[model samples]
Target: MVKRLTKHGNSLALVIDRGVLDLLEIDADTPLSMTTDGKCLIVTPVRDPERQKQFRAALEEGHRKYGKMLKRLAD
Candidate 1:
């Protein structure tokens, strides 16, 4: 989708669509990291490290608890 930057005070702002924001799980409170690969702009959420560690631990626990059942289901 094509978008034009809108005036925000003296700076410009890109108005992201609600659907896009929801799909990306981004909100007003989400901290974002912005960079440019020379030509294109890259925007990504800066994930919380502690939250990531918790998620990884939970995922590993789930796999350990359900690996056998999951393999059977896959077959």
Candidate 2:
């Protein structure tokens, strides 16, 4: 769906829909990070660094344990 930016003071803001906010579990208090690939904007919740480290560790362990079996299954 296309959305038009709303005038906020001298700048513009994209008002997020309540349903979309609820689906993403984003509230006013939740921190968000915005980035762009020069053409499109991407908005996402800021994830915890420690949680990310834990996830990477778990993924490494899973790959170490199942890499061979998974590769065989894929082929």
Candidate 3:
């Protein structure tokens, strides 16, 4: 979708749509990390370190639980 930057104080801002927000599992109060790759702008939610660790642990646990079934399917 095309978006135009609107003036806000001395800076410009692009409004994010609610659908996009829901897809990203973020809301207005979510902290975001914004960056550019020189070609495109990327915005993502910033995960707290503790939460990141917990998420990683959960992922590892899932991998262990499903590794055999996933490998069988991949074969």
**How well is each residue in 1-75 modelled by candidate 2, as lDDT tens digits?**
789999999999999999999999999998999999999999999878999999999999999999999999999
Candidate ranking under lDDT, highest first, comes to 1, 2, 3
Highest TM-score, which number?
2
After best superposition, candidate 3 residue 66: deviation in angstroms?
10
Expressed as tens digits, the lDDT of each residue in 1-75 for candidate 3 is 999999999999999999999998999899999999999999999978999999999999999999899999999
Q: In model 3, what lDDT does residue 39 have?
A: 97
* lDDT (C-alpha, whole model) for all candidates: 0.97, 0.95, 0.94
CA shift at 33, candidate 1, in angstroms?
0.3
Clashing pairs in 2: none
Model 2 C-alpha RMSD vs. true structure (Å) is: 1.4
Clashes of 3: 0
Higher-ranked by lDDT: 2 or 3: 2
Poorest stretch of ten by lDDT in candidate 3: 40-49
- Model 1 global lDDT (CA atoms, 0 to 1): 0.97
On a 0 to 1 TM-score scale, where does candidate 3 land against the true structure?
0.67
